[model samples]
Target: MGRLAVGGTRDSVGVLCQVLKTGVPSALLTSLSLAQNNLGHLSAMYIGDALAAPALKRLRKLDLHLNRLGDRGVASLAEGISAGGGMPCLDELYLGYNKIGDAGARAVAGCLEGMVVLRELDLASNAIGNEGALAFAMHLSDEGRDEERMSHVRPRLLLETLDLKENRIGDDGACAFRDFLACAGEHESGMGGGRTEEEKIGLYCPKLLNIFLDQNRAIRARGRNALQVLHTTRGIRCMEGADW
Candidate 1:
C-alpha cells in the first residue's frame, strides 16, 4: 500500500521529514519500496518513523531493502513499534541488506510483541546469525505462552510468513524453529482452534504457513532434512531452495 522509491543521492531523510512536518498525513501510504537508495546509516529509521507517524495508521506494507541502517536503526524502529507510535496497521516489513545483528533481532522481537497485525517479516542479508535466530525464537516461545504478552497484540495476529534468506543461522537455530513450529501446531490442534481461554495455550503459538530460508549456507543437507522432518510433523510449509 505504501510504495516509495526515492533513488539517487538526494537527501531522502530530510525530504521525508519535511513531508511529515508539512502534515500531509501519509496514513494511507503502504507498500513502500526504497531499494537502491543511498540513505545513510540510521536514515531508514528516520524515514520509517516519519512515514509511520501520521500516514501508517492504515499502512500495511513496507520495503526498505539495501539500506545502511545498522542494528541501532533497526532498534529505533523496534522501539517505535513497541510504543505503537508508528505503523499500527503494518502487516509486512522488508529489511534486507542491512546490518541487523543479534541485538537488532532481539529488539525486533520485542517490538513484534506490539505488532498485532504483522503477518510477514523479511530480514534477509543481515548479519543475524544463530544467536540472533535463537533470541527471536525465545521471544516467539515466550509470547506463545504468556497471555499478558498477547494482550497488546491480537491472538489472531499470527505471522503466516517469514523470509530469512541469506542469513547465517545454523542447524541449531533451524532445529529451534522446527521445534517451535511443531509445538505450535500441536497446541493449536489441541485448542480445537478456539481463541478462548478454555483451550489451553501451547508452548509455541501462531501457526506459520510458509518460511523462506533460501541461501542459508549453514543449512546443510542434513539440516535441510531435519527441517523437512519438522515441516512434515508440524504441517508448516518450508521453502528452502535458492529459488524460493
Candidate 2:
C-alpha cells in the first residue's frame, strides 16, 4: 500500500525475486522503483515474471529508469504485463533513460492495448524515431479501423499525460498525432455515438490533458505545420521544444 524505492542496490533484482518466490501480496504495493540499478534484459525478465503474480494487482506506479533494458527486454516486460491478468490498475509507467528504440516502442504499443486505465506513460530519451512515435500515437488513439466508415473507430486510453522528449519523432509522426488529436477532439465533443462527456472519457480517449514532446528537434525542422495545427487545438495542452 506504500512506495518501494530500492535503486542502486546491487541485489535489488534479487530482492524482488525473493518477494515473488515467497508469494508476497505485491498487489498492495502501489509503487516500485528500481532506478539506477544497471539492470539489463535478465533482470527485466525476472521482473516480468514477478509482475505476473496475481498478488501484484494493486501496482499503480513502476519506475525502471536508468537501466539497460534493450528491445527484447522491453518486449518481454510488455508481454508479461499484458498477460499477467493483473496490471489493470497500473496508471503510471516510467521507462526513461533507457536505450529503447522503434522496435521496443512498437512492441509496447501492441502489448498494452488492453490496459485502459493507464494514465501517464514516459518514454523520454529512448531514441524513438517517427516509426515508433507513429506506432504509439496510432495504438493509443485507436480502437480499430472500420472498413465500412473508412476511418478509425474508438480509443481505449484514459491517458492524461505522455512524455516523448529528446527522441526522433519526425514529420510523419507529427501528422499522425495531428490526425489523432483532431479525431479525439471530435469524439470528445459528444459528436460521435451521441455519448455523454463522461462516457466519451470512459470509452474513447478524451484527448490527453498534457503531452511532453519537447527537444525532438526534427519535428521543429520538418513538422512545424503539423505542430502548429496541434497547438491551435483547444482544451488539451501539448508541450514541445523549450516550452512545457
Candidate 3:
C-alpha cells in the first residue's frame, strides 16, 4: 500500500513497527497517518525506529498529531529519526497536540536541520511558549544566513507552511518570526547588491508562503500588528482565521 491510516492501538502500532523493521509490505508506502490515537511516547519510539527501516524509505508524509507524545517522546523520536540516516525522503510532518513544549520544539528543530527536503510542519495546539517559538525562528534565520554564505553547497529548506496556533507564544516569540521572515535586521547590515528580492531578504526560507499564529492569545497588539504588516505589505501571509 502506498498509504496507510490507523487510529492506532498500541498493539497494532507495535505490529506495524515490526513490519517496518523487516522492510516488507510497506515498501511502497509514501504516506502514513496515525492521528488522534493517543499513542504516547513509547509508541513514538517504536514509530521512529520503524521510520528508519529500509522498506519505508519512500515515505514522505507522516501524521502523528494528537498522539500525546510529550517532550520525552518527541525527543526520542527526534533522536531515532536523526540517527542511522533515517527518513531521508520524508517531507511533511504533523506533531501537533502532543504536549510538546520548549525542549521538544528545540529537539524537533535540531532534527529538521538535517531534513533538507522537508516542506510543511504543523506544531499547533501544543504548549510551545516563547522559548520554543524562538527556537524555530532562530533555526530558520540561521539556515538563511548559511544559505546566503554558501549558496552553492548548502541545501535550502523548502518549508512553506508552519502552523503554530493555539499555543503559548507571546509577542517576543511572535515577533521573532517577523524579523526572520522580513529580514528585519539584515538590511541594515548593508548586504545589498544587484540581488533579487528574495536574495535581498537573506535567502531564509524565501519560499515560505504562510504561517499560522492565530489563537495565541499571548500576542498583544504590537505583535499582531507586526505580523499583519508582513501579510499586507510583505509577501508572507501571517494569520489565517477570520477571528484575527
Off by over 4 Å in 3: 143-152, 184-198, 232-234, 242-244
Where does candidate 2 stray beyond 4 Å?
Answer: 8-15, 143-155, 184-203, 240-244
lDDT of 1 by residue, 1-244 (tens): 2465566443756576557534465544665566657565567566646654554556677677777667887877676566545456778888888877878887777766566678888898888877777676666654343566544534444677777878888787777676555555443554334545322333334555666777778977766776786577655566655322
lDDT of 2 by residue, 119-165 (tens): 98888988888888777666655433334533544335678877888
Candidate 3 lDDT: 0.78
Top TM-score: which candidate number? 3
Per-residue error for 164 in candidate 2, Å, reads 0.4
- What lDDT would each prediction earn against the true structure? 0.65, 0.71, 0.78
Q: List the residue pairs that clash in candidate 3.
A: none
* Per-residue lDDT of model 3, residues 89-144, tens digit only: 78899999999999999888777755667888999999999888878876775533
RMSD of each: 4.1, 4.3, 3.3
Better by TM-score, candidate 3 or 2: 3
